[model samples]
Target: MVGTYDLHYYQIDQIKRVRIVRRSDGCYVQFCIQADRNVDIQPAGKTIELDVGLSAFYTDSNGLKVDNPRHLRKSEKALKRLQKRVSRKKKGSNNRKRAVKKLGRKHLKVSRQRKDHAVKQALCVVKSNDFVAFEKLQIRNMVKNRRLAKSISDAGWSQFTQWLEYFGKVYGRIVVSVPPQYTSQNCSECGEVVKKSLSMRTHICKCGCVLDRDHNAAINILDKALKQAGYQLSTVGHTETHNAWEPLRW
Candidate 1:
């Protein structure tokens, strides 16, 4: 079959398998390649941690915050319109099929937007820091809460982490996931566990430490990751010894 193809990236290795799948927008060809992909990245000489949330896509230990794109939320109106159109049409008729297809395409667009955002953010984080740490969240369990499920899913935490690990492997950077417990509750400066509700956005401790909740959490995550890896804060960002890029499996 003759078809036009666009290469998103250069294929550097032998093709292991090929699969074709149909989607609402169009058909796509997927290629599975076997290659040890590695890029030489100079040591960034910095260590950073990330805190993911619904309000913000992520807040880094350096006080940088990336706004959440909220792809699904942004497209909800269009999706609802399309869904209504689909329902109004006669069932199993050509018009109904057309309406359903349009709805499917809109959903596909939102999904793609979410994925693109995640990939760019993850890659940027991995490339800018020599050592990267993020909280290991149980997304499956978190989504069980009906109130926050939509927001949590929209945040795409799982996708972001997957790409973070993938880029870390490809770029020879260190990526570690630390436990989520007390990351937000503990004060970064004093290590005091001050209890606070989810609505409380500021972290305050008697040790004279005050910080944004997410910012404090990011710092704690970095500390936990460093301790888990048996490395001191001063030792990070030095030299890449013994292939530290391999992710520490917890």
Candidate 2:
């Protein structure tokens, strides 16, 4: 067989198995290699929480927001054009087949883009902190909301979180997922349940605590993770009831 393949990097480890799969664009080979991937990374001695959102990719506990790429939204115009062409072509015809192929290739491009973005962002987050906390979001349930479903899917939260966990394991960092309940509604400072609609971007509490909604939620996520991990915060010092916390399984 005559074919071309691009090897991005070479693996020195023994290959356990290989598989070939066909995609819209091309056929690709995947290698399952056996090797120890663990690496030594100096502890940053810092913890962070991430709140994923449609408005921004995520807001960190330190008040930093990463803008959402909206990959599908950006490519929707081209995809629509290709799809229309496919529909216009007669069924069981060469023209229709070509048009469909074009549409499929465009979709494959968007998928790769999402994966790239997720991998880079997740690696950065894992490398920057010793402990990472995020919400245990039920993405399947969230996508049932027709009004916000597209936006949620475009954010690629599921892919991002998967990468975060993978990188955490490789780098020997802790990535924990806490319950999503009331993280956004509860005030981080005073523990008051300040109810606000989705339109309300800022969180304001009666106890003189004001913060951006996502920022406040990020802090609350961190707190929840720490408490769950048996860490007690005090003004003078910190106390730990346990030495380690296990990452939640998906």
Candidate 3:
């Protein structure tokens, strides 16, 4: 069996278990190793809240927008071609089986891409901030809308959040999931309710807080999380110097 084993580089002294799986490309062997590693948590660091969406992968409290690399959407045409090719093949034929395998491989590639992106992005976010806050999104319920179901699924918010939580546990970071209620409706600067429809992208508050809806929500999410964690906000007025946070186009 062809395999990759580099224990010296990993400093893996003991193998506890191993599992092998066959894929369309080749066989994959997973090794479970036992080793000592140091995982330290910083007590004081920058806090950030994220508002995830289809417009961008996530908009942070710092107004930084991470572009969503929609892998499935990008490969949709190729996937459709592969599916069409498979449908045209005769049942119980070798060609049919090969076509199916090719389709499966393409799907596996997309899944891997989504997972890789989520892991890297989550790791970076967690490492940069001591406390990470985000909306507790109910993806299953949200996807019930037929119009947005495809886009919501393609965003892979659940996968990204899972990795964020996993990494948070591993690195001893504080990850908080706040209630989604009024996060967008409530003005981030003036504590006023700025009601808006789903079509509204900009949050225009009567109190003079004009900002991107998602960016405002992100700030509110961070504020809510900080309050829950006993971090008090300054009572100073919402001056530009105090509340200069706004979305910047990349």
TM-score list, all predictions? 0.88, 0.88, 0.83
lDDT tens per residue, model 1, 148-218: 89998998889999999999999988899998999999888878889988889888899899889999899
After superposing candidate 1 on the true structure, give the runs of residues whose Cα lies further than 4 Å from its correct spot.
1-13, 232-250
Q: Could you give the C-alpha RMSD of every candidate to the true structure, in order shown?
A: 4.2, 4.4, 5.8
lDDT winner between candidates 1 and 3: 1
TM-score of 3: 0.83
lDDT of 3 by residue, 127-171 (tens): 876667899888899899888888788878899898888788777
lDDT of each: 0.84, 0.84, 0.80
Candidate 2 lDDT score relative to the true structure: 0.84
Give candidate 1's root-mean-square deviation (CA, Å): 4.2
Worst 10 residues of 2 by lDDT: 234-243
